[model samples]
Target: MTEDGGRRGRHETEEERADRMWGELIQEVRVAQTGVQILFGFLLTVVFQPKYDRLSHSDQVIYIVTVVLGACATGALVGPVSLHRLVSGFRVKPRAVRLASRMTFVGLLLLLATMTSALLLILRVATHAGFVPYLVAAVVAWYLLCWYALPLWARRRHPVRPGDRAPDLPPGGPGPGRRQGRT
Candidate 1:
């Protein structure tokens, strides 16, 4: 039971919750990091390619922008690891977790932009067709749907209610959102 009289949600302390969430966040970041690193590596090599010299000025600009976006995305994705390394043993895991989460979110947004720009540049160079923009738009829309919409929909559809215990937790454990009752 909480001071506010609401039922506790989990049995873990703040630090414990932070530890669990930090581990999960790192795992998620690892997946994103690998992808962004690969993309950024490929982007970096594009300027050295023989065909790069034949690209139109506009295409060159687009390629440059895509590379910059990729670099930014990579930095943002890797920021959490640095944050943890610097802040470890500071007794601020909870705050660090929150900050890391925000960094990861920003990284994901940057990654989306990076991918979209890269796709547009690729298709433009490959086809030079009038429909390239449309095709890129469609792909960006698909990414938004898959990456953002579905998760948001599920989160909205099934929210955690006050007093509702997490499934994995044993019953009657004192935790956040749990009501305290007379013994």
Candidate 2:
């Protein structure tokens, strides 16, 4: 019941944008929440195992830190659900979306830390060779490259200027499928 009677209407306002953004955020949260929950569940079971006791004090410390980070990540990632529950129908969706986006961003950072530390711990325990740290560092670099660096480089390098034309072709151009002929 909006301008276009659907999602293709006028530009969304801060409030409408918030509502829309919230829906998008919820979808995003579903993916991250599932992952964080699975990770947290797995982390919870490690304490009961026998090899867990054999871990060095340092490894144990890393495990504890990783678990804490994973727990925090889960909480922050799931914060949007609680936030939506608390703020739904309050007529302040714009602010809620912004807040939830921030929380989700923080949650992603926490998830990164949790995963990194978890990887470090697993690699350290599974292979006591001197090259474990190096291997972990390489993997971390690859993650950073794939997750952040490549996108950043693309964004910076292929930026659109203010006067740049869009990729739309005019009425009968060589766009989709059109061979020149009669009308």
**TM-score winner among the candidates?**
1
- CA RMSD of each candidate after superposition: 7.3, 10.5
Off by over 4 Å in 2: 1-10, 154-183
Q: Compared with the true structure, what per-residue lDDT tens digits does model 1 show for residues 66-104?
A: 898998999999999999999999999978877887788
Badly placed stretches (over 4 Å) of model 1 are: 1-7, 163-183
Q: Residue 63, candidate 1: how far off, in angstroms?
A: 0.7
Q: Using lDDT as the measure, which candidate wins?
A: 1
Among all windows of 10 consecutive residues in model 1, the one with the lowest summed lDDT is 174-183
lDDT of 2 by residue, 1-183 (tens): 233443322344446655666787789889989988998899999989999999999999999999999999999999988988998888877677767877987887788888889889988998888898888788888877976678566655664443231222234332322111110
